[model samples]
Target: MHRATFMELCDLLSPALKRKDTKMRGALTVEKQVAIALWKLAMPDSYRSVGNQFGVCKSTVGAAVLQVANAIIDQLLSRVVTFGNVQTIVDGFTALAFPNCDGMIHGTHIPILAPEHRGDQYVNHKGYFSMVLQALVDLKGHFTDISVGWPGKMHDTHIFRNSGLFEQLQEGTYFPDQKITVGDVEIPTVILRDPAYPLMPWLMKPYACTLDSSKEQFSYRLSKCRMVVECAFGRLKARWRNLLS
Candidate 1:
């Protein structure tokens, strides 16, 4: 991460990560805790190896990493990753040739070590233990919303339906009183997804086995727009090799 970005994150997380010194010994400063966590995330190393570099015990490293991670999530998630007003989202997708689209939704598998119990629940069709990270990304390749911790064995559609985003859409409060015009027809803002997802008023999927020219054209345009989510996931996994490993 860039120095400025890291500092900004630290500032945001300070409230949550700040520690009170005890009489026995001062706790590790927030800076050191964040550094330890960042190092662990940036490298694929065991806790013991990371602890050796930081001159701390393996358990301390683990605790610090988890603490810093939760702090980041609590402080930065809503601020950095959000879907703004409906008009802005519509304009973003319109620029990509996908009229009436609010965002693109997809899911990727994040591999993980098998757990002690119910390990089979994490084993996906790809024959590996993993977790699913379902996300909605805007045209700029930024995540607008994300759902994590679902077992890989679950279908992408199942994960999406169970997500908070799905609840928001069902409640009809995510983009209230907003409509988009596509040629002659007016429709509500919708998210674009693949065949794995279900078609709904707020979510759209390409027509399967399209033979009509218009349908094919629509599918082509939707695919081009939906590819943004895949690219976002690709860039994320590439930048964080720990996710891939």
Candidate 2:
């Protein structure tokens, strides 16, 4: 991150990360705490390695990582990850030839160390320990909504059904209850999904079998537009190299 951006983050996290020095030792500054956490997240390094570089013990590094992470989620997550200006998002997707589309929904597996308890639950279809990160990617390739840390053994359809986004969409509370008529079909604002997901009024998926030219064209357009989410995932893992493993 740029220096200005990092400083701004420190300011935002100060309320939660600020600490007082005790008699035993001087407290770590909020900047140092955030740095430690970011380092751990950006690098595939061990707690001992991070502690050595930061001039602290492994326990301190671990504590700082957890504290800073919790602070970011509690203080910054809602502000950054949000469904902003729904109409604008719809307009953006409309320009891309998918009318009344809100966003693209997809799930990616994030590799993780197997937990001691119920480790098998984290083993995915690929037979590896992982967690699921299901995200809603907007037209501009930003994450509007994310459901992280679901067990990898679970399917994308299951994760989406259980998500808060699913509830809102199902109740007609997520996007405006507006419809656009395409021929005889009146389509509501919907997010594009893969064939693994079940079809819904607010969610669309490619046809299992393209029996005609029209169905093939529809599936082609949906697949082409849905590439945004795949690119977003690539960028995420690229920037956060720790997730590559």
> What is the TM-score of each predicted model, taking all chains together?
0.89, 0.90
Write down the lDDT that model 1 would get. 0.88
Pairs in clash, predicted candidate 2: none
Q: On a 0 to 100 scale, what is the lDDT of residue 176 in model 2?
A: 81
Q: For residues 156-206, what per-residue lDDT tens digits would candidate 1 score against the true structure?
A: 988988999999999988777678677898888889999888899889889
For model 1, the superposed segments whose C-alpha errors exceed 4 Å read: 1-5, 181-186, 242-245
What C-alpha lDDT do the candidate models reach, one value each? 0.88, 0.91
Please give the distance, in angstroms, between residue 129's alpha carbon in candidate 1 and its true position after superposition. Answer: 2.5
Worst 10 residues of 1 by lDDT: 236-245
lDDT of 2 by residue, 152-203 (tens): 9998888998999999988899888889999899888899999999988788
Worst 10 residues of 2 by lDDT: 236-245
